[model samples]
Target: MSEIIKIDSIDNNGRGVARRDGKAIFVDGAILNETVEANIYQKKDSFEVATATRIIKESSARVTPRCPNYGVCGGCSMQHIDPSTQVAVKQRTLEDNLWHIGKVEKAKVLPPIHGPYWGYRYRARLSVRYVRKKNDVLVGFREKKGRFVVEMDTCPVLAKRVSDLIPSLRACLNNLSCREDIPQIEVAVGEETVVLALRHMVPLSDEDTQKLLDFAKKHDIVWWTQSKGLDTLKPLLTNSSDSHKLYYDIPQFGLRMFYEPSDFTQVNPFINRTLIHRALNLLEIESSDRVADLFCGLGNFTLPLATMAKEVMGFEGSETLTERAMQGAKIHGLENKVSFTTLNLFDVDKEWLENLGFFDKMLLDPPRDGAFAVCKALTEMNPSLRPKRIVYVSCNPSTLARDVDVLVNSGSYKLLSAGVINMFPHTAHVESIAAFDLVC
Candidate 1:
């Protein structure tokens, strides 16, 4: 029998750690400062896997999860813990990763960026399955450890408007001729509009199309259909030009960016705005300075930076996204100040860096893979062209820490400040921003 130990604290991954017989046992559904009886499932030499069987003593941070399937649905992990505590845990996780893994400490820890805990998720990919045995269609996120879709009538994390339409969507799909053919639905909610991207393995009949159109008209939602790859996505009806765009206005910068449903966008628009404001503040660009916005998706930061800088050069891997960014700049009449180029950032070279010319300030918002090659290339560039200041927006803590190490130890950049952004409230995903300044 595996001995149970009191969980001392929560780890970066949201698991609670307890020591039993000199071995670290990780228990799920256990909170910090709580005594829980856990049942060990997997026993390893140095570590063990366990699930909380009973809560002997509860932590003050523990709260009743809003969703009945909170523990079973993989969509959220920290819902059982208070929202305030969730943010605190994430902030500490960011600091611990930076200090222990990166071997570098930030000069300052900025206050964490947080927003509405519930009804905050504006984007989600919901799995769809038709369970004939249950005489119903299962939609929403998958069950925590199970492959079966959670029979969710509504999702609390989804925007209130979108959450209310979940049942209607399920009913509409359930009645379609090719109900079983539909595998998933992608939800993208913007300031004024909501788009649903239906991924179908088979073609929809005329009746099915009309049913979808009727549903769209009834709910005042936009319907987009994807038969295959991303490029194959198209509107179900011909008069959806206005409905297809997801719009958000950045009043602070006097800018608005429109995007398609399938495009990459911040799930939480509120926090996104906050993050952009913070990054711009950290850059503290002078009117004479030129900035480079690497991995600039649809000019999310590039256009805002352009308003303050003399010139802003944006680089992205997708030609489609680059063209969209260019269009956005033109729409906002900032094209004169903003320029964009399409290049694979993962394999950036010294030649590419030199071709881009000199930049005083840099903003890198790379994906989870991190911008190792881009950072390395910048470090190897001619001294005259190397950016003096850099702001890195990262979605993964470990990679951020690793890249921070490279910048601090080898690239002669001093860590300025680092902090977490609670973009996804209930999940373990961590979004962080760090600033670095070149040391003369």
Candidate 2:
């Protein structure tokens, strides 16, 4: 059955939202204000999910999707809309999350930060599958509707080198004796090299290892293999040097950040640089000020803070990340000005925060869970002990709002400003930054 509905808004998942007889319906492939004929796929008590089969009236913002696998692949959702409009939807999503979830409003709104429209993704986890029925291997993102890998040759949003390697990669892996046992491939493109970590469930034969090495050499790429877990991910060849190491540079800060294949790094390099710059500007770090960077992954923000502040203390849950952060500081000759502590930030309380002493300013770059425990602790700690200013970099709007709620409503902090960062364009991933200042 088909129903013609007018889209009212775009949901957090980038689906077009419509109302029919007081019930909400979410339509895929439909844009706001567009009248579309949709086929209902999933139905719940309060809302129904549908896929737009025909557009009766099209939105001006809608554009022809570039990728052939646009609707089929699960990698991106908003490619049908214009790029600028994509950023706008994301910005509105951030604002709505703040108002509805946090029950607070920002005193100011920062302009959305964005970069290139395509070929910006520097990291990806491509799925691998060997189908006995087809007698061939499939490599790419999962299909939108199921666990099957997308039958795609290239991904436009991914880094060009890595995107171009897809076809050859599949052919090379399919030739391997253990192709059926290979499950996934991690793509990490750095300024100097492209690293691919192949995770296999079984051991690779000598022929398979030689084939990977030959492929790496032919493509001028490095191959890392994982037999079981992250601990097993290492260079396929033991003789590889620092030149083969994966790293990206922040030319603005004169810093180079290095990480392993399994570590987390922003997929978009351009916006990551600008976001860091915008965050530091909001921090207003003085030469005499001492700063704290919570959940600082590999000192992405902490080292930059050190460049402007008297001293900076970094904290993370994993000791390995903290160790990497310190090494990065030392490489930049910032060892004297920065320190790191490893503790589970999720488990912190008021007493623990108070013991850390007073910091003139603080930066929180937490994961999707947001800095809830830390924000709660800030509210309970002595007013004098709390930082005067804070800059939060978040990837999830809902959790950011939840943590920001504790900071603004429960704590003495005021929501100074907040805005979205189009870090992952054409996708529903909403990256945002917010600022706060002590009010009491």
Candidate 3:
């Protein structure tokens, strides 16, 4: 039996922290201000892994999760913790990583940005499996710490309308003649419609096609089928009135952007708008200033920045993404103000930066790999075209801190201000935005 320790706080990964025998211990399913007896699962050189056996005392922030299969489903981790407290923990996580990892401090810690806590997931990739023993079909996210998909009848994190279709989806698949042929279902909700992209290993029979068409008509859903890669997806019905395009509207900017199901997009639309506004505000764009948006995906930030700046250049690795961005610019009547290029950012060169010309402001929204190569190339560029101000938005803190070290120590940029955005409420994933200014 592991020694019972009172959990003093929670870590960035949603684990409870406690001290046992002068050593740090991480307990799962235990929250802050909770005194619980734990069973040690594994022991490492410096720390121990445990699971709470009994909760002698519970924290005030603890709440009964809404989902029946809360712990088993991998979709949500912080559902047990209060929603307001979830934002506070993410804010502290950003501050701690900045001070501890980068050895830097922010001039100001902006208040954390938050939005709807439940039913905010507008995008999801759900797995589909056929259980031979039960002679039934199961579809949803994978189980926590397991390889099998959880048997979820409903998902509370999905939009209410989407959640309501779970049972019908299961029944629809079970009744199909190609029941075992289907592999997965991708759900994406747009401004006016919901798209279900079904992945199948074999072609659907005529009867199966009729069933799918009946289901689509009865539920008022658009059905798309994919037999091979993403490019193989096509509509099953000929007379369906659903638009093939998926789009979301940004009322604040009067912008409606269209994207494909496989394309990258902000998971939470509400928080994404807020993040774009905050990042632009921190950049302090001027009418005469030119800006560059790196790793620009579907022009999420590029289009908005173009509205305020004199000229904006967006760079993306995929030519398809650049093409979509160009289309968006044309639709918004800002094509003259914005120009997009396709370049491999991982292998950037000084000459590439030179060709792009001078920019006064920059925004970096790279993936989890971070932008080390691009950062190095920018710092090595001639001093004449170096951007004066930059705003970095990242999903990983460790990589963000490492990149900040390079920019602060080797480059001319200095960390100005940084804060967190609770884009995902119940998960351990943290999204942050930071500002840097040239220290000439």
RMSD in angstroms between candidate 1 and the native structure over all alpha carbons: 1.3
Clashing pairs in 2: none
Q: For candidate 2, lDDT tens digit of each residue in 251-307?
A: 998999988877778999999999999999999989999999999989999998999
RMSD of every candidate to native, in Å, equals: 1.3, 1.1, 1.7
Clashing pairs in 1: 72-144
Estimate the overall C-alpha local distance difference test score of candidate 2.
Answer: 0.91
TM-score list, all predictions: 0.97, 0.98, 0.96
lDDT: which candidate is best?
Answer: 2
Quick one: RMSD of model 2?
Answer: 1.1
* Cα displacement (Å) at residue 222, model 3: 1.2
Clashing pairs in 3: none
lDDT of 3: 0.87
Best by TM-score: 2
- Candidates, ranked, TM-score: 2, 1, 3
> Order of candidates by lDDT, top first?
2, 1, 3
TM-score, structure 1 vs. true: 0.97
Off by over 4 Å in 1: 1-3
